[model samples]
Target chain A: NAGVTQTPKFRVLKTGQSMTLLCAQDMNHEYMYWYRQDPGMGLRLIHYSVGEGTTAKGEVPDGYNVSRLKKQNFLLGLESAAPSQTSVYFCATRQGGAKNIQYFGAGTRLSVL
Target chain B: QQQVKQSPQSLIVQKGGIPIINCAYENTAFDYFPWYQQFPGKGPALLIAIRPDVSEKKEGRFTISFNKSAKQFSLHIMDSQPGDSATYFCAAENSGGGADGLTFGKGTHLIIQP
Candidate 1:
Protein backbone atom coordinates (compact mmCIF):
# COMPACT_ATOMS: atom_id res chain seq x y z
CA ASN A 1 0.00 0.00 0.00
CA ALA A 2 3.07 2.22 -0.08
CA GLY A 3 2.47 3.19 3.53
CA VAL A 4 5.12 5.90 3.22
CA THR A 5 7.30 6.87 0.24
CA GLN A 6 10.16 9.39 -0.02
CA THR A 7 11.44 10.62 -3.37
CA PRO A 8 15.05 11.23 -4.44
CA LYS A 9 16.39 8.40 -2.30
CA PHE A 10 19.83 10.00 -2.72
CA ARG A 11 20.89 13.56 -3.43
CA VAL A 12 24.05 15.62 -3.45
CA LEU A 13 24.08 19.37 -3.08
CA LYS A 14 26.74 22.02 -2.72
CA THR A 15 26.73 24.71 -0.07
CA GLY A 16 23.93 27.26 -0.42
CA GLN A 17 21.99 24.94 -2.77
CA SER A 18 18.34 24.25 -2.09
CA MET A 19 16.35 21.06 -2.36
CA THR A 20 13.02 19.59 -1.41
CA LEU A 21 12.23 16.07 -0.25
CA LEU A 22 8.77 14.70 -0.94
CA CYS A 23 6.94 12.23 1.24
CA ALA A 24 3.67 10.53 0.32
CA GLN A 25 1.43 8.21 2.22
CA ASP A 26 -1.68 6.28 1.31
CA MET A 27 -2.72 5.28 4.80
CA ASN A 28 -4.88 8.41 5.26
CA HIS A 29 -2.98 9.26 8.36
CA GLU A 30 -3.65 12.60 10.07
CA TYR A 31 -0.14 13.35 11.34
CA MET A 32 3.24 13.42 9.62
CA TYR A 33 6.79 14.23 10.74
CA TRP A 34 10.30 14.82 9.40
CA TYR A 35 13.33 13.47 11.26
CA ARG A 36 17.09 13.40 10.66
CA GLN A 37 19.28 10.48 11.74
CA ASP A 38 23.02 10.79 12.27
CA PRO A 39 25.67 8.39 13.48
CA GLY A 40 25.53 7.90 17.29
CA MET A 41 22.47 10.13 17.31
CA GLY A 42 18.98 8.75 17.09
CA LEU A 43 16.36 10.32 14.91
CA ARG A 44 15.55 13.94 15.77
CA LEU A 45 12.33 15.57 14.73
CA ILE A 46 12.72 18.64 12.55
CA HIS A 47 9.11 19.49 11.87
CA TYR A 48 5.66 17.99 12.03
CA SER A 49 2.08 18.56 10.92
CA VAL A 50 -0.94 17.40 12.81
CA GLY A 51 -3.18 17.71 9.81
CA GLU A 52 -3.30 19.31 6.41
CA GLY A 53 -2.38 23.01 6.51
CA THR A 54 -0.91 22.91 10.01
CA THR A 55 2.78 22.70 10.84
CA ALA A 56 4.89 23.01 13.99
CA LYS A 57 8.58 23.01 14.89
CA GLY A 58 10.08 20.10 16.70
CA GLU A 59 13.38 19.74 18.58
CA VAL A 60 15.50 20.87 15.60
CA PRO A 61 13.67 23.08 13.11
CA ASP A 62 16.35 25.48 12.01
CA GLY A 63 17.65 25.49 8.42
CA TYR A 64 14.57 23.68 7.18
CA ASN A 65 10.94 24.26 6.39
CA VAL A 66 7.95 22.04 5.88
CA SER A 67 4.61 22.31 4.09
CA ARG A 68 1.67 19.96 4.34
CA LEU A 69 -0.45 21.24 1.52
CA LYS A 70 -2.25 17.95 1.11
CA LYS A 71 -3.52 15.42 3.61
CA GLN A 72 -1.35 12.69 2.18
CA ASN A 73 1.81 14.57 1.38
CA PHE A 74 4.47 16.33 3.48
CA LEU A 75 7.37 18.20 1.94
CA LEU A 76 10.66 19.17 3.60
CA GLY A 77 12.67 22.01 2.13
CA LEU A 78 16.21 23.09 2.73
CA GLU A 79 16.62 26.78 1.95
CA SER A 80 20.40 26.68 2.20
CA ALA A 81 22.13 23.35 2.32
CA ALA A 82 25.22 22.99 4.50
CA PRO A 83 27.61 20.18 5.28
CA SER A 84 26.09 19.87 8.74
CA GLN A 85 22.74 19.25 7.12
CA THR A 86 24.03 16.06 5.56
CA SER A 87 22.19 13.18 7.14
CA VAL A 88 19.59 10.51 6.48
CA TYR A 89 16.09 11.94 6.48
CA PHE A 90 13.01 9.98 7.30
CA CYS A 91 9.32 10.76 6.89
CA ALA A 92 6.76 9.21 9.16
CA THR A 93 2.99 9.27 9.53
CA ARG A 94 0.60 8.39 12.31
CA GLN A 95 -3.08 7.86 12.57
CA GLY A 96 -5.35 10.11 14.61
CA GLY A 97 -5.57 9.74 18.39
CA ALA A 98 -3.07 9.60 21.19
CA LYS A 99 -0.29 7.01 21.32
CA ASN A 100 -0.63 6.11 17.64
CA ILE A 101 2.16 4.18 16.02
CA GLN A 102 4.28 5.90 13.37
CA TYR A 103 5.13 4.37 10.01
CA PHE A 104 8.35 5.57 8.38
CA GLY A 105 9.73 5.76 4.86
CA ALA A 106 12.85 3.98 3.69
CA GLY A 107 14.73 7.33 3.99
CA THR A 108 16.58 9.83 1.81
CA ARG A 109 20.35 10.07 2.09
CA LEU A 110 21.51 13.63 1.46
CA SER A 111 25.10 14.76 1.19
CA VAL A 112 25.82 18.49 1.20
CA LEU A 113 29.32 19.38 0.16
CA GLN B 1 18.67 18.12 28.08
CA GLN B 2 17.97 14.73 26.51
CA GLN B 3 14.57 13.50 27.62
CA VAL B 4 15.21 9.91 26.80
CA LYS B 5 18.62 8.35 27.40
CA GLN B 6 19.68 4.95 26.01
CA SER B 7 22.81 3.22 27.14
CA PRO B 8 25.46 0.91 25.71
CA GLN B 9 25.88 2.41 22.25
CA SER B 10 26.65 -1.08 20.92
CA LEU B 11 26.34 -4.70 21.96
CA ILE B 12 27.50 -8.10 20.71
CA VAL B 13 25.78 -11.33 21.59
CA GLN B 14 26.03 -14.88 20.31
CA LYS B 15 23.15 -16.57 18.58
CA GLY B 16 20.56 -17.97 21.01
CA GLY B 17 21.60 -15.43 23.61
CA ILE B 18 19.32 -12.75 24.93
CA PRO B 19 20.18 -9.10 24.46
CA ILE B 20 18.64 -6.48 26.68
CA ILE B 21 18.55 -2.78 25.84
CA ASN B 22 17.67 -0.21 28.46
CA CYS B 23 16.25 3.31 28.26
CA ALA B 24 15.47 5.90 30.93
CA TYR B 25 13.32 8.97 30.58
CA GLU B 26 13.51 12.11 32.64
CA ASN B 27 9.96 13.19 32.03
CA THR B 28 7.50 11.49 34.28
CA ALA B 29 4.52 12.48 32.18
CA PHE B 30 5.51 10.20 29.35
CA ASP B 31 3.09 7.29 29.21
CA TYR B 32 4.00 5.53 26.03
CA PHE B 33 7.27 3.73 25.36
CA PRO B 34 8.22 1.90 22.18
CA TRP B 35 11.24 0.18 20.72
CA TYR B 36 12.14 0.40 17.04
CA GLN B 37 14.43 -1.83 14.98
CA GLN B 38 16.25 -0.49 11.95
CA PHE B 39 18.39 -2.37 9.49
CA PRO B 40 20.93 -0.99 7.06
CA GLY B 41 19.39 1.21 4.36
CA LYS B 42 15.94 1.03 5.94
CA GLY B 43 13.69 2.95 8.28
CA PRO B 44 13.05 2.03 11.89
CA ALA B 45 10.09 -0.27 12.47
CA LEU B 46 8.18 -0.82 15.68
CA LEU B 47 9.41 -3.98 17.32
CA ILE B 48 7.43 -3.71 20.54
CA ALA B 49 5.79 -1.23 22.90
CA ILE B 50 4.51 -0.80 26.43
CA ARG B 51 2.30 1.47 28.48
CA PRO B 52 2.77 2.69 32.05
CA ASP B 53 -0.08 0.56 33.27
CA VAL B 54 1.69 -2.64 32.37
CA SER B 55 4.93 -4.07 33.72
CA GLU B 56 5.73 -6.21 30.71
CA LYS B 57 4.52 -7.03 27.23
CA LYS B 58 5.79 -9.71 24.88
CA GLU B 59 5.35 -10.65 21.27
CA GLY B 60 7.30 -13.50 19.74
CA ARG B 61 10.89 -13.12 20.91
CA PHE B 62 10.70 -9.42 21.74
CA THR B 63 9.54 -8.06 25.06
CA ILE B 64 9.24 -4.67 26.71
CA SER B 65 9.55 -4.23 30.42
CA PHE B 66 8.24 -1.03 31.86
CA ASN B 67 8.82 0.49 35.28
CA LYS B 68 6.56 3.47 35.62
CA SER B 69 7.70 4.49 39.07
CA ALA B 70 11.34 4.35 38.09
CA LYS B 71 10.75 6.07 34.75
CA GLN B 72 12.60 3.32 32.96
CA PHE B 73 11.87 0.76 30.26
CA SER B 74 13.82 -1.95 28.52
CA LEU B 75 13.62 -4.22 25.48
CA HIS B 76 14.60 -7.86 25.74
CA ILE B 77 15.15 -10.06 22.74
CA MET B 78 14.99 -13.72 23.62
CA ASP B 79 16.75 -16.40 21.61
CA SER B 80 18.49 -13.81 19.50
CA GLN B 81 19.43 -14.72 15.92
CA PRO B 82 21.79 -13.24 13.38
CA GLY B 83 18.77 -11.84 11.57
CA ASP B 84 17.92 -9.99 14.73
CA SER B 85 21.01 -7.82 14.40
CA ALA B 86 20.01 -4.22 13.89
CA THR B 87 20.11 -0.76 15.41
CA TYR B 88 17.47 -0.41 18.10
CA PHE B 89 15.96 2.85 19.27
CA CYS B 90 13.95 3.61 22.38
CA ALA B 91 11.37 6.37 22.24
CA ALA B 92 8.95 8.10 24.60
CA GLU B 93 5.88 10.28 24.23
CA ASN B 94 3.17 11.69 26.39
CA SER B 95 0.32 10.17 24.46
CA GLY B 96 -2.03 12.33 26.46
CA GLY B 97 -0.80 15.09 24.20
CA GLY B 98 -1.96 13.76 20.87
CA ALA B 99 0.00 16.06 18.57
CA ASP B 100 3.45 15.80 20.12
CA GLY B 101 5.81 13.52 18.25
CA LEU B 102 8.09 11.01 19.92
CA THR B 103 11.40 11.82 21.69
CA PHE B 104 13.95 9.22 20.65
CA GLY B 105 17.14 8.12 22.39
CA LYS B 106 20.60 7.65 20.80
CA GLY B 107 19.96 4.10 19.45
CA THR B 108 21.83 0.90 20.24
CA HIS B 109 23.62 -1.25 17.69
CA LEU B 110 23.06 -4.93 18.38
CA ILE B 111 25.10 -7.57 16.61
CA ILE B 112 24.13 -11.19 16.93
CA GLN B 113 27.23 -13.26 16.19
CA PRO B 114 26.49 -16.42 14.30
Candidate 2:
Protein backbone atom coordinates (compact mmCIF):
# COMPACT_ATOMS: atom_id res chain seq x y z
CA ASN A 1 0.00 0.00 0.00
CA ALA A 2 2.94 2.32 0.41
CA GLY A 3 1.27 3.89 3.41
CA VAL A 4 3.91 6.60 3.82
CA THR A 5 6.99 7.23 1.67
CA GLN A 6 9.98 9.50 2.31
CA THR A 7 12.48 10.46 -0.36
CA PRO A 8 16.29 10.69 -0.21
CA LYS A 9 16.83 7.77 2.12
CA PHE A 10 20.17 9.29 3.08
CA ARG A 11 21.85 12.64 2.60
CA VAL A 12 24.90 14.60 3.71
CA LEU A 13 24.68 18.34 4.13
CA LYS A 14 27.37 20.83 4.96
CA THR A 15 26.60 23.34 7.69
CA GLY A 16 24.44 26.26 6.58
CA GLN A 17 23.11 24.31 3.59
CA SER A 18 19.37 24.16 3.08
CA MET A 19 17.41 21.07 2.09
CA THR A 20 13.93 19.66 2.06
CA LEU A 21 12.74 16.16 2.88
CA LEU A 22 9.67 14.93 1.06
CA CYS A 23 6.91 12.79 2.55
CA ALA A 24 3.97 11.36 0.68
CA GLN A 25 1.09 9.28 1.90
CA ASP A 26 -1.52 7.53 -0.25
CA MET A 27 -3.97 6.81 2.57
CA ASN A 28 -5.78 10.11 2.14
CA HIS A 29 -5.23 10.91 5.77
CA GLU A 30 -6.16 14.27 7.25
CA TYR A 31 -3.14 14.59 9.50
CA MET A 32 0.57 14.45 8.77
CA TYR A 33 3.64 14.95 10.97
CA TRP A 34 7.41 15.36 10.74
CA TYR A 35 9.70 14.07 13.43
CA ARG A 36 13.41 13.63 14.04
CA GLN A 37 14.99 10.73 15.89
CA ASP A 38 18.25 11.08 17.74
CA PRO A 39 20.18 8.95 20.15
CA GLY A 40 18.67 8.98 23.66
CA MET A 41 16.05 11.47 22.49
CA GLY A 42 13.52 9.15 20.88
CA LEU A 43 11.43 11.03 18.35
CA ARG A 44 10.72 14.75 18.59
CA LEU A 45 8.03 16.38 16.55
CA ILE A 46 9.30 18.98 14.09
CA HIS A 47 6.08 20.24 12.58
CA TYR A 48 2.66 19.00 11.58
CA SER A 49 -0.23 19.72 9.30
CA VAL A 50 -3.84 19.10 10.20
CA GLY A 51 -5.07 19.38 6.65
CA GLU A 52 -4.15 20.87 3.31
CA GLY A 53 -2.54 24.31 3.57
CA THR A 54 -2.40 24.25 7.36
CA THR A 55 0.72 23.82 9.45
CA ALA A 56 1.78 24.07 13.11
CA LYS A 57 4.99 23.98 15.09
CA GLY A 58 5.84 21.10 17.37
CA GLU A 59 8.05 20.63 20.42
CA VAL A 60 11.32 20.92 18.49
CA PRO A 61 10.42 23.13 15.55
CA ASP A 62 13.12 25.71 16.01
CA GLY A 63 15.21 24.97 12.90
CA TYR A 64 12.65 23.32 10.65
CA ASN A 65 9.70 24.37 8.57
CA VAL A 66 6.94 22.38 6.91
CA SER A 67 4.50 22.76 4.03
CA ARG A 68 1.41 20.77 3.19
CA LEU A 69 0.16 22.33 0.02
CA LYS A 70 -1.48 19.02 -0.95
CA LYS A 71 -3.33 16.49 1.12
CA GLN A 72 -1.02 13.62 0.19
CA ASN A 73 2.28 15.35 0.78
CA PHE A 74 4.09 17.12 3.63
CA LEU A 75 7.50 18.68 3.19
CA LEU A 76 10.10 19.45 5.88
CA GLY A 77 12.60 22.13 5.09
CA LEU A 78 15.79 23.00 6.90
CA GLU A 79 16.55 26.66 6.35
CA SER A 80 20.15 26.31 7.41
CA ALA A 81 21.28 22.86 8.36
CA ALA A 82 23.57 22.62 11.37
CA PRO A 83 25.64 19.87 12.90
CA SER A 84 23.21 19.53 15.78
CA GLN A 85 20.38 19.08 13.30
CA THR A 86 21.76 15.77 12.03
CA SER A 87 19.36 12.96 12.77
CA VAL A 88 16.99 10.43 11.27
CA TYR A 89 13.80 12.04 10.06
CA PHE A 90 10.46 10.26 9.96
CA CYS A 91 7.13 11.10 8.41
CA ALA A 92 3.84 9.80 9.67
CA THR A 93 0.13 10.01 8.90
CA ARG A 94 -3.06 8.91 10.59
CA GLN A 95 -6.52 8.36 9.21
CA GLY A 96 -9.11 10.83 10.44
CA GLY A 97 -11.78 9.56 12.83
CA ALA A 98 -11.69 8.08 16.29
CA LYS A 99 -8.66 5.97 15.38
CA ASN A 100 -5.29 7.40 16.32
CA ILE A 101 -2.84 4.78 15.15
CA GLN A 102 -0.03 6.50 13.21
CA TYR A 103 1.75 4.87 10.29
CA PHE A 104 5.39 5.83 9.68
CA GLY A 105 7.74 5.94 6.71
CA ALA A 106 11.10 4.19 6.42
CA GLY A 107 12.97 7.40 7.42
CA THR A 108 15.62 9.73 6.00
CA ARG A 109 19.08 9.80 7.54
CA LEU A 110 20.65 13.25 7.48
CA SER A 111 24.23 14.01 8.34
CA VAL A 112 25.24 17.67 8.69
CA LEU A 113 28.95 18.20 8.53
CA GLN B 1 9.67 19.33 29.02
CA GLN B 2 9.48 15.55 28.64
CA GLN B 3 5.87 14.61 28.97
CA VAL B 4 6.44 10.91 28.81
CA LYS B 5 9.25 9.28 30.80
CA GLN B 6 10.45 5.76 29.97
CA SER B 7 12.76 3.70 32.11
CA PRO B 8 15.60 1.23 31.59
CA GLN B 9 17.32 3.13 28.79
CA SER B 10 18.70 -0.28 27.78
CA LEU B 11 18.00 -3.88 28.67
CA ILE B 12 19.53 -7.27 27.98
CA VAL B 13 17.88 -10.62 28.59
CA GLN B 14 18.15 -14.24 27.62
CA LYS B 15 16.40 -15.57 24.54
CA GLY B 16 13.43 -16.94 26.45
CA GLY B 17 13.28 -14.27 29.11
CA ILE B 18 10.72 -11.56 29.50
CA PRO B 19 11.55 -7.87 29.10
CA ILE B 20 9.36 -5.08 30.37
CA ILE B 21 9.59 -1.42 29.36
CA ASN B 22 7.73 1.16 31.40
CA CYS B 23 6.59 4.70 30.71
CA ALA B 24 4.98 7.39 32.81
CA TYR B 25 3.28 10.52 31.63
CA GLU B 26 2.29 13.69 33.47
CA ASN B 27 -0.48 14.81 31.17
CA THR B 28 -3.81 13.75 32.52
CA ALA B 29 -5.48 14.46 29.20
CA PHE B 30 -3.57 11.71 27.47
CA ASP B 31 -6.02 8.93 26.73
CA TYR B 32 -4.13 6.85 24.25
CA PHE B 33 -0.86 5.01 24.81
CA PRO B 34 1.10 3.06 22.23
CA TRP B 35 4.38 1.22 21.87
CA TYR B 36 6.52 1.38 18.76
CA GLN B 37 9.44 -0.82 17.72
CA GLN B 38 12.25 0.26 15.43
CA PHE B 39 15.13 -1.65 13.98
CA PRO B 40 18.56 -0.20 13.18
CA GLY B 41 17.57 1.88 10.15
CA LYS B 42 13.79 1.75 10.01
CA GLY B 43 11.04 3.97 11.30
CA PRO B 44 9.17 3.16 14.45
CA ALA B 45 6.24 0.82 13.82
CA LEU B 46 3.25 0.37 16.09
CA LEU B 47 3.62 -2.69 18.23
CA ILE B 48 0.59 -2.51 20.49
CA ALA B 49 -1.66 0.07 22.09
CA ILE B 50 -4.05 0.57 24.98
CA ARG B 51 -6.70 3.01 26.04
CA PRO B 52 -7.35 4.40 29.49
CA ASP B 53 -10.52 2.39 29.87
CA VAL B 54 -8.64 -0.87 29.51
CA SER B 55 -5.96 -1.95 31.93
CA GLU B 56 -4.46 -4.46 29.58
CA LYS B 57 -4.34 -5.32 25.88
CA LYS B 58 -2.63 -8.32 24.39
CA GLU B 59 -1.58 -9.18 20.87
CA GLY B 60 0.23 -12.46 20.49
CA ARG B 61 3.37 -12.38 22.64
CA PHE B 62 3.28 -8.64 23.21
CA THR B 63 1.07 -7.00 25.81
CA ILE B 64 0.39 -3.53 27.17
CA SER B 65 -0.38 -3.06 30.84
CA PHE B 66 -1.86 0.33 31.54
CA ASN B 67 -2.54 2.14 34.81
CA LYS B 68 -4.88 5.03 34.31
CA SER B 69 -4.71 6.26 37.89
CA ALA B 70 -0.95 6.31 37.97
CA LYS B 71 -0.62 7.64 34.46
CA GLN B 72 1.83 4.87 33.80
CA PHE B 73 2.00 2.03 31.30
CA SER B 74 4.33 -0.75 30.25
CA LEU B 75 5.13 -3.17 27.43
CA HIS B 76 5.92 -6.79 28.14
CA ILE B 77 7.58 -9.08 25.67
CA MET B 78 7.15 -12.77 26.45
CA ASP B 79 9.49 -15.54 25.35
CA SER B 80 11.75 -13.05 23.70
CA GLN B 81 14.00 -14.07 20.84
CA PRO B 82 17.24 -12.67 19.49
CA GLY B 83 15.33 -11.35 16.53
CA ASP B 84 13.39 -9.14 18.95
CA SER B 85 16.43 -6.99 19.65
CA ALA B 86 15.57 -3.44 18.73
CA THR B 87 14.65 -0.03 20.10
CA TYR B 88 11.22 0.50 21.63
CA PHE B 89 9.43 3.74 22.29
CA CYS B 90 6.34 4.54 24.35
CA ALA B 91 4.10 7.37 23.29
CA ALA B 92 0.93 9.12 24.41
CA GLU B 93 -1.67 11.37 22.87
CA ASN B 94 -4.74 13.10 24.19
CA SER B 95 -8.15 13.28 22.55
CA GLY B 96 -6.44 15.63 20.10
CA GLY B 97 -5.69 12.59 17.94
CA GLY B 98 -3.24 12.63 15.04
CA ALA B 99 -3.19 16.34 14.40
CA ASP B 100 -1.56 16.92 17.77
CA GLY B 101 1.22 14.50 17.06
CA LEU B 102 2.44 12.14 19.78
CA THR B 103 4.55 12.79 22.89
CA PHE B 104 7.16 10.08 23.12
CA GLY B 105 9.47 8.83 25.84
CA LYS B 106 13.18 8.63 25.31
CA GLY B 107 13.10 4.95 24.20
CA THR B 108 14.39 1.59 25.36
CA HIS B 109 17.07 -0.36 23.59
CA LEU B 110 16.35 -4.06 24.09
CA ILE B 111 18.81 -6.82 23.37
CA ILE B 112 17.79 -10.46 23.60
CA GLN B 113 20.92 -12.50 23.94
CA PRO B 114 21.27 -15.69 21.94
Chain B, candidate 1: TM-score? 0.97
lDDT of 1 by residue, A4-105 (tens): 999989999999999999999999999999999999989999999999999999989999999999999999999999999999999999997864699999
Model 2 whole-model lDDT (C-alpha atoms): 0.92
- The i-RMS of candidate 1 is 1.7
Clashes of each: 0, 0
Task: After superposing candidate 2 on the true structure, give the runs of residues whose Cα lies further than 4 Å from its correct spot.
Answer: B96-98
Model 2 CA lDDT for position A80: 97
For candidate 1, the C-alpha RMSD (Å) to the true structure equals 1.1
The alpha-carbon RMSD over the true interface for every model, in angstroms, is 1.7, 1.7
Top TM-score hit = 1
**TM-score per model for chain B alone?**
0.97, 0.96
Give all candidates' CA lDDT scores: 0.93, 0.92
